[model samples]
Target chain A: MTSRRIESFVGHGALILGALIALYPFVSIVRHALGPAAGSNAAGPFTLENFTRAWVGGGFSHSLVSSAIVAVGVVVVTGAIASLAGYAMAMLDVPWRGAIMGVLLIGLVLPAEARIVPLYDMFEGWGLLNTYWAIILPQIASSFSLSTMWMTTYYSALPKELTESAAVDGANSWKAFTRIVFPLGSSALATLSCLIFLYTWNEFLLALVLLPQNPAVQTAPLSLSFFAGAERNTQPEVIAAAAVLVALPVVIAYAFLQRRFIQGLTEGAVKG
Target chain B: MSLGHRDVAAPEKRRVAGRALRSRPATRRAHRLRTTAWLYLLPGFAFYGAFSLWPLIETFQYSFYKWDGITAAKWVGLKNYIKIFTSEDALSTFAHAFTFILFYAAIPVVVGLVIVGVMTRVRIRLLGLLRTVLFIPQILAMVVVAVAWRWIYAESGPINAALEAIGLDSWTRAWLGDFKTALPAVGLIGTWVMYGLCMVLFIGGSQKIPRDLYEAAKLDGAGPFQEFMAVTLPGLRGEISVALILTVTAALRNFDIVWNTTSGGPGNATLIPSYLIFEGAFVTRQVGYAAAASVVLTTLILLLTGGIQALLRQRK
Candidate 1:
């Protein structure tokens, strides 16, 4: 009895400790953001002035809007493309299935560093640098690999009778897809959307490299980097506030859709 | 929810469709369906080809030429690749990236195994809540994580303050600024962001293990450690491979964290390949050299992931 009790205590102790370690940084930053603007009294009297400073002085208002636009644009386009291609790959008689999977696998495994330079040159050549297309187009292109893979996996797991019955009822492929398969895959779509939104919102390197010349297209994370860099010495509170602002949307999305987020990440491994 | 009923009815419905399809000209239908399928695939593949595949091929092509993104291209085959292999500074950058695999991949996987080992002994309550909290770091912008940690590691930050309070001021130098500690300090941040993911994957994988195995282990009088080794470790092979592939890739392609925190500073103590490629391409205008570095980095990622997959497959 005592040994069982000790094991229980030890397990709970380790997990709680790990949880606290993970949670501490955000708590500290939030406290710091609410503290006095000039000093670093982490738990000082709470105030909202730092947010206003970071929002207005740091140009976060504009950057956050830019982030929203870019994220939404990439999500909508990638979702459509992924759904169509994934449906064809899993259900329909898509030709060159092996070759297509090969291409996507290359995209999936290859690092972004491998192609960033040529992309830069290509965009620059077309005078597309600093445009929202410069960021959104490439993101959609790169995101296709993961998104299509996700959708294909989800669709392939469904019972074949759903589509077969629709076919017997004289429903064309498009009709069957629109009415049955797509609606049935809502949970999967929701999971994919959550993952894509989080990834797009948090994307940093692409934004930094592609959108530096245009303030209107710069993302919140990139802007926050510049904000924190300039104000690290003099305005730690504002930098903390800026960090909070940059992280807020995804954190909120994560809070409400935590299950979907977790499902998207672990589904592949768990099923295996 | 209807999947149960659909599973039973699937063969009947498939036969009906198969008969109806036989009434039509099969080859014509096959050709038409193939064409339609290609239509569905075209948009996605077109974008991927233009922005991803073509650029990737272009990177390889540009790697063989000496051009500043403006001047007439001079073909210098193998020279750029030779420099990466021969240059001390360039070689160290690759080494630093590989070093991150220890902190980012190996540490996280070990921590995850330890947690799983502990977990097998007792049931954890509020697991969903714990998972959400632990997984937050993975989703947050790396810039935000870096900003928050930068303060914690600052001279006047919590670590320094704690050291001063404990009369250990000598041990309180800037964590990110010191040459010897910079790489490890940065690498440890990767650990903090990564281990949670490993834990979650392992936990998810563990639940799929059959209860009979645990009962059998208990019947055989196995200790907790022995039970974990005999059952839990083997059950989590696939999850471990996924975790290793994800974390190792994150480590090797590490840029945003190093960018926001240190910018490969303090005499290039934290410089990695991605950072070097960025600097060479844009900042220093060594375009061809940067392309070669990127190709090397990409090759390394593919080789390592392929190696991990093969290793795990053999074990299975």
Candidate 2:
């Protein structure tokens, strides 16, 4: 009985310790974001002035717009394209299913850092520098794997005889797929779409490389980089507030789609 | 939700609409299908072809040339590649990246699995709340996390003050500035953020193991450790592989955190390949050399991930 009590005590102690480490950074960020307005306290006086200054005319507004443009572009173009490619792989007995999988999975391994320079060269050649498309186009491809992989899994689980029946009814393959496969894949699509939106919204590296230096075209994070003019003012509180603004949309979004988002990520482990 | 239920209702609509569509001509429908498929696919294809695939190929092409990105190109095939291969500084940057991974890969994956394993054994009242709190770091910007940590790691920061009180003042240093410790310091924070993700995956995967296996292990006088080895570990193979693959990839591409924190400072002690690539291309305008470096980096990731996939498939 004494040993069992000791074990329980150790277990609970560890859990509490782990929990505190996890929560500490968040508390720190919050503390810093609303640092005290006056008096020389390094930890601070606790005010909202930092947040207000960061949000109002503080140049994050441009990042908001740029990030939106790129994210929406990803959802509409990349999301839709991946659905089609996924549909093809899941349903059609194409001669190259394995090859297509290999191609997409190749992207799974290739990090943006490896390709950033090449992308810069291509965009410059095409005179696409400082344009929304430069950032949007690359991000769409990066997000393709998430969409295609999930959609294919969703589509394959669907009963095949339905499409076969539609074909017999002379609806042909496309009609059958649209009227049959697409509707069946909606739940999976919703889950995948939510993830894609969040990923493109949160993406940083590619945006920094591809977008223009112009204030209007720069993303929220990139704007934040140049905001204090690169290591001058050193306002950690204002930076945290700006960071909070950048993360706000995705946080609200995940709350709504929490179930599906978790499912999509854990699919390899649990569901599949 | 009604949406999930709506999907369950879709098959019935297909069934009802089937007979009426049969009266349509076959070839005409096939033609329409072709057009629709192409139409649905064309835009995405163009976008990826223009932006992603072409640039990948172009990276190889650019690596062979000496171009200032604006001026006319000069062909110097394989020279840039050879230089990077021979350069001590460039080689050390990769060594730095891999050294950081010692903390990033091993620690995060271990901590994550431990948390998940513990959660399974315990009946925590606020399990869901715990999961959400752990995941907060993944969503927060790297800049905020780095900035917050910078303060903590400062000489007079709370962390050092506490250490001094505990008679461990000798252990303190400017973590982000100290050449010896900077990479590990940044890497540890990454491990912290990532373990939460791993925990989340493991919890989902563990629930799927049949309860009978555990019960059988219990009847055989097996402790939780033995039972986990017999049941939990095997069942968790897929999640473990996924976590390893994802974490390793993130480690190789370690940029934003290190960028925000050190920027490869203290005399290039923290320089990783990504930082070097950024300097070569954007900052220095040695676009060609950066392209060569990028190709090498991409190839290394491909080989590593490929080896992992092979190992996982072989185990299966």
| Candidate with the greatest DockQ versus the true structure | 1
lDDT of 1 by residue, B24-78 (tens): 5765676788898888899999999999999899999989988787788899999
Q: What residue pairs clash in candidate 2, if any at all?
A: A36-A45, A36-A46, A63-A220
Model 1: residues >4 Å from true position, as ranges?
A: A39-44, A268-272, B1-24, B314-316
**TM-score of chain B taken alone, candidate 2:** 0.86
Worst 10 residues of 1 chain B by lDDT: B1-10
lDDT of 2 at A44: 38
At residue A66, give the lDDT of candidate 2: 80
lDDT of 1 by residue, A21-107 (tens): 899888899999888776544364888889998999999999999999999999999999999999988888777788888788887
Clashes of 2: 3
The top-ranked prediction according to lDDT is 1
lDDT of each: 0.86, 0.71
TM-score of 2: 0.87
TM-score for candidate 1: 0.94
